[model samples]
Every structure is written in structure tokens, then in C-alpha cells.
Target: MSVPQAKSPPKAFDADSAQRALRLARETLQIEANALIALDQRLADGDHSIVQAVQLLLNCHGRVVVSGIGKSGHIARKIAATLASTGTPALFVHPAEAAHGDLGMITAHDVFIAISNSGEASELMSIGPIIKRMGAKLIAMTGNADSSLGELADVHLNTRVDKEACPLNLAPTASTTAALAMGDALAVAVLDARGFREEDFARSHPGGALGRRLLTHVRDVMRSGADIPAVSADTSLSAALEEITKKGMAMTAIVDVDGRVLGVFTDGDLRRLIEHVQDFTKLSIADVMHANPRTIEPQRLAVDAVAMMEEFRINQLLVADADGILVGALHIHDLTRAKVI
Candidate 1:
């Protein structure tokens, strides 16, 4: 690996120009914010376009095909991803590419959303008629409701902004922000209407933290079988200590003939026992064990076990079956290693 050298900013872009830069940034944000605010207010004025668009999307039996050209293409791809993650099946296709061969990806059951701020993208305009003729619902998101693309659409979403955030007003700044916000609004509305939930989202993102919390069960991360440190209730304290050390759990479960949990003796209990008793060579495991210890079921989520541990301030927990039989054990390290803590 090579270390890179640090360099100073150019004289033209030094601290002297920071105030101008900050002013431009704040003005850009305010302009974009105002555009979103205007959009929200417009939607509240008995707008049938948005409602009709949502209805078509919710009723779509096939995927939602989102297409755009140039800068709008970037926004369209992100919208498609957001929709897909939030329970609506969607995909992005380049307008130019769709005219070549990707149009086959669309079907009669689909709802095709075309995004173009100016509503005048030549590529999208070229195929707008064909998409509608093929029976797919055409939705146009544009700054101009009267533009060719919007006029051809079954539903036209007005993503108009008073002006661009760019100083020259040529760049698609506020318009693109408005389009992005509108897409987010659609996704959220669809997500709510479909009754999408955290668990559903977690299923789609199984490798994420929420998935690990919801999908991982106690049985999936506990120490089971011979790996458990356990002993008979009448076993000597010395033998219980040996079992705890051999299993390397710093604790031992005191069980009966059927392995039903009678009590638990851990290192914490041993330290307390030493203060109360002088010689414990003759003491049975049951005499010094903590009875009726906090236990979790094997079927519970690992995250639930973590909550139980935190609530009780216990570092170790026992897993019991319906019959009160000790099935397994867990140490805080187990949860940590499983990334559930």
C-alpha cells in the first residue's frame, strides 16, 4: 500500500471564497425545499392525477417499468430501486435502450412510468405511442403538463419547479429534486396501501441488521447438547465447578434425571458463596445454586434474548423447553458472535 501526499486547495478556491460557496449552497437547498413544499401543497388541492396514478400502480399485476433519458435516467433508476425495496416490484430501463430491445420487458399488465423534466425527451417521445398502444398504462412525470410526453400519457404527474437551483437556470436541479420527492411519495403511499411491514422489508434484506434481529432464533445461536455445562442437582459443588470450567461457560445448569432445569450456578454465585461459607467441600450443587433463574425459550428471536438479558442485567441465560427441560444455554459472547447484541 502506498501513502498519498496531502495537498492544499487552489488559491481561487481558498477560505476567501468560502462565504460565497456557503451562500450558493444554502440558496440551492432553499430553492429545492421550496419546490418540494409547492409540490406538497399542489397535491392537496383535489389532485386526481396523483390518486389515479397510485390506483394504477397498486392494481398493476406486472412490474412497474420506469424509463428516462439523460439526468432523468439517474433519478428514474433510484425511484425504481426505492419502489422495489418498499414492496412495489419495479425496474428502470433507458428510453433509448427500450426502443432497441428492452421494450419486450414491458407487458400489458404493467404500468410504465416515463420521467423527463422537460417532457420533450426525443427517445421517450418516440416510444410513448407504442407503449400505450400495447395496452401498458403510460404515466408521465414532467415539468410541463402540456408537453408531448405528458399529453400522450394516461396519467401526467406535474413535477414543475418555478426555476432551477443552478444560477444559469439550465441545469436540472430543483426539477430533479421535485421528481425524486414525488417518487418517494408514491413509494411510501404504495407501501402503506399494501400494508408493507418491517418484517417484510427485512425478508428482502436478509443480510442487514434488522434481518439478523428478526430472523435469528435462540436455537440458531445457542450452545446445545454436550457443549452445555450441566450436572445433577445433587452433584457436589466441586463437580459443578469442574463442569463449568470444562465447558468454559463460567456457569453450570443443575438438572434432574430428565434434564429439567432445577437451578443455575455461575461464577457470580460462586464469588457470593465464598463470602457466606467457609468450607464448601461437602455442599451439593443444589445448595449453592440460584433457583428459578431467568430462562428463554429456544424458539424466541435472538434479539429478544438480548432484551431479556439487558432487562435482567444478566450476562448468561438458560434455554428451556415447554416441559421446563434444559435444552441449551447462551452466553453474551454467543449473541455478540452472532451479531444479535
Candidate 2:
């Protein structure tokens, strides 16, 4: 055994040192990128292993159990999360933990994925056979196909990298990158084959921004009842201005006796009216209101209202029914408050 001596601390971070750092970073990125390119090329070479793995996942009646050791465990957890969020039922169980009691998480109908760069992680290798005997199909992601884990797998995905990004070539850099890329490829392919939609992904991530955009409806954010600013068609323009100010929506909807939307009066229309007419106090609402205002249905998504507002270049919109009667109102601020903007 040899005791390695520690080196002195780094010098001041000057231009020369910055260049060295940049060069190393660029080389590391290029190496990892090359590894991904090689993985893609290998998959392109008439490899049905990935296809088989995807099929197994698609047909899985239970959750996909992913297990790995060391750095591979991190990648496996990410793969499990991606799969679960994209419509697949999946979870990560540490290989060592599975050897203890987590093995019960695996059922006969589930698909088990074991990731090991060298295909010889003792923990995973020990439990892999047990999971297979339990009737769960096994998929192996490894750099070595001849290793025991690969041999025990129903399908093997080769994640071999020619070399590592680490200058010593002993660190897990390129190998872990390749394994993660392959895992992502599998999850994406399975989700695509399963016809996963954005809304489905949102369902799995309801607290996320996409969930707010997809799951939130116009009715959920729109101002209804006393909150909606409205007036009759025959009302004076001065009175409509009061409704707009009272509602703080900067606009007012004009409906007929049947409560059907006929027009809209906005601050912009008011400004234009003021510029033209000096004393228009007696002006009727119908005379100044813009006819046929853009309207949206309450059942429509709040995101759709955002699109409508952007397209029409307006701030306020009337929520209407199939009969074109006003039900509620929406302002850009409402969407902002709901985090749907």
C-alpha cells in the first residue's frame, strides 16, 4: 500500500487558471456528449433490447421497481420519477434495502430494473435472481453484458462508454451519463407508446405550474355574481364607468334585457370617447360600447383565456354560455393571481 501525499492549494484564480478550468469543463462535456452519441448509435444498430424493455414496461400491470447501487442509484431514482410522472407507475427501491425488506415491494406483475455500470453490484446481483423468481420481469442496464446481472435479466441495455470524462478514467462520469441517458430513452419511449399527454403528466404533478395551467378552468378564476361588473345597454356611459370603477376590472359588460352580452365598455374605449366628445355625460352605453366583445366559456381552460387575451390584445373578457349570456368575467390579473399567466 502507498500513502499519496497531498498537494498544495490552488493559486489565485487568474486568466490562465480560468482557461485551464474552461478547457477541462469543455473536454468533460465533449466526452459525456460523445458517450451519449455512441449510445444512440448502438441503439440505432438494430437493437431490439430497448424495444423489449419498453414493451415489458408497457405491459406491466404493477409498478416498475428500479434498483441500483452507488451513483447508479441516483440515476435509477431519477428514471423512476420520470416514469411515474409521465404516466407509468414506477418507484425506486435501493438494492441493499431490497435485500432487507423492500423486496416485498416487487410483485409478480411488476417490472424490475437493475442498473449497474459493471453489472456486478453485489447487492443488486443478490436480489435480482430473487425478484425474477418472484415472477417479476427483469431489465438490466449495464456496461458489461457478460456480468451476472446482465445474464439474469430478461432484457439487457448496453450503456458502455469507451472511456470516462474523469482524467484518471476511474470515476463514474461517462458510464453513469450513458446509463442515465439510456434510462431516459426507455422512459420516454414507453410514455410515448402509452400515448401520454401533457394533461396526464399534469395529473401526476398537480402542484406544478403545468398542472395549474391545465387543470385550472376559466370558471375557477373568473369573477362571478357580485364580483362581475355589468350594466344594461340603455344605461348612461357615466353609469357604466361607475360599475367599472366599482368592480376594479377596468371594463364593464353590457347585456340586454335577456342578460345576453351585447357589447363591452373598457377604459380604452372611454379614453377614446373622451378625446372625441368633451361633454358626453348623457351618452348612452350602447352608443359608446364596442359591439361584439370577445367572450370565452367558463368550461374552457384558464390558459385558453390567456391565449384569447393575448390574441385580442385586451385585459378583460366576459365568460358566456352557449346562449351568449354573460355568466362571469375574467381579467388578466385574475389569471396572474391564479398563477395561470
Task: Estimate the overall C-alpha local distance difference test score of candidate 1.
Answer: 0.93
Candidate 1 local lDDT, residue 207 = 92
**lDDT per residue, candidate 1, 240-316, as tens digits?**
99999999999999998998998999999999888989998989999888898889999999999999999988889
Candidate 2, pairs of clashing residues? none
Cα-based lDDT at residue 81, candidate 1: 98
1-341 per-residue lDDT for model 2 (tens digits)? 99998999978999999999999999999999999999988878887799999999999999999889999999999999989888888999998988899888889999999999999999998898899889999999999999999999999999999999999999999999999889889989998999999989889888999999999999999999999999998898888899999999999999999989999999999888878899877789999888998899999999999999999899999999999999999989999999997
What TM-score, to 2 decimals, does candidate 1 have?
Answer: 0.94
lDDT of each: 0.93, 0.93
| Candidate 1, superposed: residue stretches over 4 Å from native | 1-11
| RMSD of each predicted structure | 4.6, 2.3
